[model samples]
Target: ERSGASMAQPETTRVFLNNVDSYASRHIAQVTFEACTDSVKAAALISDVEAELVSNHKRTFQVVGTVSHPSAVERPHRLDRDELLSKLMGCDVVIYNVTQHADQVEEALWAASALHSEVEHFSGPKMFILISTIMTWACSKPADPDDLELPFTDAIFWSRRAHPNFERHIDLEKRVVKMGKTVSLQLFSTYVVAAGLQYGMGEQIFHYFFKKSWLGEDGPVFGDGENIVPTIHIHDLASVVCSVIQHQPRPYYLLAVDDSNNTMEEIVKKIASVLGPGKIQKKPSEDAFLTKDLTDSLLVSLRMEAAYIKKLFSFNWVCQFGLVENIEVVVQEYRQSRGLLPVRLCVLGPPAVGKTTVSKKICEYYRLHHVTVKGTVSDTIARLVSSLLSPPNQSELSTLNRNMNPAGLEEELLLNVMRDELMTHPCKNQGYVLEDFPQTREQAKELFDGKEEDLSCVATEFVLCLEATEAFLLDRVLNLPESRVQEHNCEPENFSRRLAAYNEKQSEDDVVLNYFYEHDIIPLQFGNPNAEADCLPLMQKVIDMVGQPRNYGPSSQEVKEEERRKAGERLRREAQERAEVEQMEADEARARAARWAEWTKKLEQVRQQEEEELEATSRPMRGYLMEQVVPTLSQGLTACCRAQPQDPVDFLAEYLLKNNPFEA
Candidate 1:
């Protein structure tokens, strides 16, 4: 490295400028180059520096022109590749600041190469200085033999091979040197190392670990205790980058600032201390590190050395704060950011009374994630029907018979399925927004019976009691889409009839806070043809109310018990009414049976009397004819012939014989 009086001046002689708010300001002449314009972080840092320079230095700098690239913004008659090259034909120095990715690096190199080639064409030796990161090198892992080759071979190869020992700055250094250009690489280790955990993009590990307490009291640890981590403050990292650009180092530089290195155990212990002391158990060596997948690339042990860069840059940034100092801050901030209040809210309402929609709006307004129950009456019914009719096979016949029999079987099946699904769903951990569930008063009773304690806690913390008019509900039911109608296995024409029955059974007074009026629970009034937007503000208000903190109030257990008592009373009345109806039906059936028995007995007696009369008449006729008719007739005829007188007796006998007709 060359070291002499030239050190007093800024090493590099070129500057890149970006986002000049007002062009008329002092301290601008020194700003020959603009900060990288592509990145949000870079842009923000430059803005801050620009503001500071304008406020304090009051200096103005001239803009030679702006660099043009395909990715940059568009303009009329914008400089083409040839024009851009012509402009930089004899520039003595060039500055590069962009992402540290392999492709980005390659693009930067190409741009610099173009500038240098043009300068050489015009008879000037160009000096180039590049600013980048080592993380990019670590990100470049070798591709598997089976992996397909990408278009940029050099970028792919470098990104893959560069890891624990490879410095991102070193790679840039190697590339610049190969191109015969001066390059300086600046590397910062672990930017923004806070004493406490912070939540950023993706599934934040801290939130995962603390919110769910995945690690219990003790956090996770990986590998042997020999891994070293170099940490830096984000502010420090930005300052160093700016400093390097200002000073313009000769060949290359690496920046790292941290008070000391602590093992994973030490960090975990510090977190535990802030969280209050607890059992800090270590996983057995046989146990594979649980976070291996998450921390594999970013782990300190598997990382390259930041010490060389730290020495070269001579940056004095420090991580003076320990875990205890900021652990609470981090934890509180994470909780606030996630809207994870201690309170739990459970909204109760009739089907299609806007429970789900309201719950969603509440969650959105409060920045809380809302979870819902997996199944409902309609969903369960659909599943049952699907199962019964599936495959169109012999088995389906038996299933159908079992499911569709008896009038009330459908409702029963739906209740059972809903209960099972709710219990099994993943959202049970975070509670849920229930819709079109707890169909019957009995079902609701059963739901809260054994789990009264839990239910009470949930209700007290967050409970919204909902109700609506019968007429409004009837209209809603009628206009429901064909999908919903089919899902419940109901016809559209039958909607009014079904809703009437539902209302009769589970009357509003039975389920709502006041069967007649609204209470503390958010009340949503909807008319015919409900519009979701009409009620969004009310829903949002309820959500905001539930999220606010309150003084220690009544035990959720007590509130739940009161609800349970009321539910039990409602169920008892229903059971009594059901028993009375069953008894009346039995009595009616017995009266019908008695009437039928009386009619059958009278018909039997009539048939017996007719048989007896026929037998009596036949026996008397036979005796009279046999004993008297033959002898009397013979004697009378002989006497009448002897006398030969008035045939009165003969005529009488003939008449009697003709009239009697018992001749057989």
Candidate 2:
């Protein structure tokens, strides 16, 4: 009868998980909300709990998440204190996590204080749970002083002490419990869950070590590396949060850690072996790249176990055996979460078949490097020549100086150079597009030979062959512009010779096609006469043949950074354009003003010259009038007045006639 009812019906439980903005809180909220839902796969760590709990009641979560830094503009996820309180009042179970951020400890205490103050006017039985960290017990004294290896468990949680740096967390935990005791008369209760160091989904505290290992660097270990750092997968930690929300166990303090007691050295070595070149370097505690809090957490020597969870909960163990034991799944999560996989490709084609063009397009679209013979040969020879300057290769330098043609070196040396280029960091990380390489079957074999069971890291995922008919190739060469013809050596005679060489069939045993066929890799043949006319369709076909990308696109953080960069570029361009226009306008106005000023000065000089000329011509006439005309007219008039007779008129006329200035 009990079994029948367990499978008979389903119910819903509204749960509130706060601080969803944090790394730990986000995982807990996601697991609690999605534990029994049909939309998402129930967390693997809580499969047993899911089977038991979903059989009776389903859970729905009201998650409150906020950004770490406050924004000037309002955001939907950034809730205020009143808004947070309102969300808290509506849910049956409220979970506030103080594990990730120190500030969250204050938030948890505030929630508890608010609950205690409002317990008298309660609506329903509300349980307030605080998710904390095992670091709080980093300095705890073991119950048995004689047994130094005694493991700390939740049964002895009362005797646990905090590290000197984590007193604030311990104080907050105590206050939360005190507040819960004050609300005993009402339907209110509190629980403090101390979780182990979390690892998974790219990680938080262990991210520095994970990234260094992934980059194939020497993983750094602090101090002697013998400290036992207890760890739990974030999924498992979330499962513990789910279990607490559902069961509401009797204990107020619960220790959440895995079964494994692996030391720091064991964990670092395991990570390096799985992802890196299996190298580790020990450094002083002060040399670690992690923040002070994380460094302290990483160097912690406390050993802890989830004794209460093991005895009371029925969840399946996801990394409950611990991180080093389940390194593969954790490493996969790390790679996929960060999008750090490479997608290598090789392109093959006859001359004038658009091999370089298509390879460049593919590299641009996929964020890959275009590796070609010309570039690789030049770079490799340059590096070899540069290396010759060192004392270790002095003999090689002398030999190279004697021979100008480094390209004439043995085939083995060239092959090694190409192999080295293929193994470069960019090719291993972002990926590479090899263009027109391995022309012969023997060359392909030498470059790509790998072990019997495993492929080399530089092996190509796909091979593309571009082909065209002889008639099409001939016509295309004829239609090429003079510059293009000269640049590619595609004149009629040269083009025909190259085409014939490309078409000549190889012996059955020595064909390059046979090499690929034997390896079960069929070359994708793409032949389109109009491919050069429009390249998008060809690119699309190639993309379809390749299928989904092996590596992920830009991450969210990268996208935001790119957006900011584009915005800055646009603003800079606009400012430059505005400045140019303003300068041009200023120059035009100055030019016009200068021209007007010059014209006005020239007009003033012309007017002054005309005035001076007029004065010089009129000055002689004025002097003659004053010196001759006035005296002559005065003598004539005096004679006429004295005569006063008929002959006087004739006398005055004779006197004036003889009185001309020049004649006198």
Candidate 3:
């Protein structure tokens, strides 16, 4: 509560981080260490607290219990109150992290009460930071624009699974603030999944739906996905927790969420694009339990305003991994989980260059499926025209025969081809190589500008631009085989016309080229189009950029078995150490008792002798004084009287004042 006074000081503060076992809490604990103390907690199997932040975490953080583990009940449920109290006694700060439920605050506070001391009058500079969710905001209302900065005295007890036990959290937060003015109670509200390489709630649910849909068991389900879901990266959330830990902000219910301005439908489409595309079936919202909590929150149109936190701590996700980017992470993870490589690329260049050749080489080198947009478009036109001519399905043919633009058909085909290739073996091994696509400005704009709704997860890591001179282009076009010319309909005159059109359309400020360059897809122009050149070096360069996709899959049995083996080792080692410590302490206690007994016996003997000596000396001295010294002194004093026996008072005074110097 008293952190305000010492906020500027660097303290070797002990922070009691609760819920450290959780996925999110571990991040907070890791980042909080740099800002707090560096002293290790002495790594032990029984110690729930980490001795150090080794990378992210070194072990599973279980609840450290005072009582021994007995499988009779849940072995690791409660903390040993006295043992925990001892640790709490040393801590200067307590970070009360709560998730899952608001009633968790009570358990945390109860644990913290062990740190309290009435006699100490702990009006603490000691702080207790309550890092809770906005779902914990207990007001009967959804959000309080007016009193966003204030506390709610009264609140509703009941809420959806999305926000349950909110009233208790509110009660706890208010009580904590009232109890400790300087303590922080930050309530963060996030609507959607926190971004990362995660496969927890929403991601796993999405994966299930994707698997079902892909297997034709079920379709991707969302009820008209226009719900606005606030999103934030896990890293950003971790950073926010660190900021609060480092600079304890003024205690308030600070609502922090990413301002990803995408509707729920857009996010799902992005997910679907990666998983595999199919028509999404409308599912009832009420059917949503865990799976639909994602969209249900959005359906509520609930969003957290990050303005408050931003004003205070400049809350921002530097990665800027927004809705689609997060979806990309989950998609990549999904693919990797299935022993599939996740990679997407596109090669764009002008007419009559080695674009197709270089792409084919790269695809062959990597065992990837090489896709040519022109060929796919041609095939698509053929198929669609054939469908239109044949009236097998009269209704389907009627829809196909509608007045559709050639350009639109080409664009649709391009997307379809890319999607189809990505879903198949093109992405099975090393991923696909897209070539001779995005020729026109519109196509480039549609693919690269993040505008096309149909195109999802079409991020290109590299754009290989094979440059050729006008003479080389003309030569390649004009010298084409008769059969090649007849097949494609690009004759010598057609080549000149195509070259002219390309030159006219292609300018230094070409939108397509600029788009790639702006997105860090700057063209790797490496070709002597005037003459044939080896493209191995260029292909290698592209490979270097793409890097190697991790071949590891998630949750292998071997890995889990290894972890179990390590846990067993740790447990045995810890048990041995505990036994050693107990034995050592017992030995020391016995040694101390023996030494105390020996010292006590020796001291008692010495004391008795001293008493005997004192009594013996006193008897001799009394006898000497009474018998010899007193009689001799009386005679000497009588002989040496100062006054000549004249006056009694004078004689007494003279005797008392007389120095025996003359007589001695």
Which of the two, 1 or 2, has more TM-score? 2
TM-score of 1: 0.35
Candidate that beats the other on lDDT, 1 or 3, i.e. the better one: 3
lDDT of 3 at 263: 58
Candidate 2 regions exceeding 4 Å error are 1-10, 36-75, 80-83, 120-123, 142-147, 178-186, 222-224, 281-283, 289-295, 351-430, 434-464, 468-605, 612-620, 629-664
lDDT of 2 by residue, 412-498 (tens): 655655777787756766678998777678777887783252337677777888888777777777887899889877888877777
Descending-TM-score candidate ranking = 2, 3, 1
| Span of ten consecutive residues with least summed lDDT in model 3 | 187-196
Error of 2 at 489 (Å): 13
- For residue 168, give model 1's deviation from the true position in Å: 7.7
TM-score per candidate: 0.35, 0.66, 0.42
Instruction: Name the candidate that leads on TM-score.
Output: 2
Residue-wise C-alpha lDDT for candidate 3, range 427-491, written one tens digit per residue: 53345677766666566665544443544444566677676788777677677678866655467
C-alpha RMSD values across all candidates: 26.4, 9.5, 32.0
TM-score of 3: 0.42
lDDT of 2 at 167: 90
Score candidate 1 by lDDT. 0.43
